[model samples]
Target: MLGVRLDTELEERLANVARTQGRSKSDIAREAVRRYVELHDEAFRREARRQSQRASRRDTQEDYAFWEQAEREDAAWR
Candidate 1:
């Protein structure tokens, strides 16, 4: 249950669109909000995935470096 305030000009535009589309302004607003939420949700998911991939790559590189150093130390002992 949310109330939105639109300016006079915008209100008229919305009214015209609603009249032509044979739909209520509330319906149009609801669909717009739904799409907005979905778009941002997908963007958030993509960023999270990218961050996870970056962290995984960093961890893999660190592990490789550690093993390489260990190998060098072992060769020196031999």
Candidate 2:
């Protein structure tokens, strides 16, 4: 079990919401924590997927050669 301490005002608000919704404060807090963690985990997974996708894109020799040519042209112009 996790113990959390909230500000007095927030605690009172939570209690009012809990009473109005007919749900225990524990239940509401648990669901909120679960959803928060789920969103964060999902965001991590998406970033991992993006990194893997970028890693899968191979840079060919021709691409490197083009950049080299561009750099030489810029150096000459300087």
Candidate 3:
């Protein structure tokens, strides 16, 4: 359960939309909130995936450098 307070102008706009659509205000508000949450959730997930990919690339580069250094040391001992 949630409560929302709207100013007069916005409230009137909502009322008009609700009336034209033959839907209750609560229904419209609920759908709007649901869509908003979904949109942001997807955006958050995309950012997380991007960060993970960047970290993976950094690790791969570090691993390659470490192996290259080890190879150089081995050649020096031969």
Taking every candidate in turn, the Cα RMSD to the unseen true structure, in Å, is 7.5, 5.5, 7.4
Span of ten consecutive residues with least summed lDDT in model 2: 54-63
Error of 1 at 15 (Å): 0.7
Let me know the TM-score candidate 3 reaches against the reference structure.
0.75
Per-residue lDDT of model 2, residues 1-78, tens digit only = 799999999899999999999999999999999999999999999999999898678676878899999999999999
lDDT by residue for model 1 (3-68), tens: 999999999999999999999999999999999999999999999999999887786778989999
C-alpha RMSD between model 2 and the true structure: 5.5
Q: Please write out the lDDT profile of model 3 over residues 1-78, one tens digit for every residue.
A: 999999999999999999999999999999999999999999999999999999877868789899999999999999
- Candidate 2, residue 73: the lDDT equals 100
Lowest-sum lDDT 10-residue window in model 3: 55-64
lDDT of predicted model 3:
0.96
The local distance difference test score of each candidate is 0.95, 0.94, 0.96
How many clashes in each candidate?
A: 0, 0, 0
User: For this target, which candidate reaches the highest TM-score against the unseen true structure?
Assistant: 3
**Model 2, C-alpha of 74: deviation from truth (Å):** 32
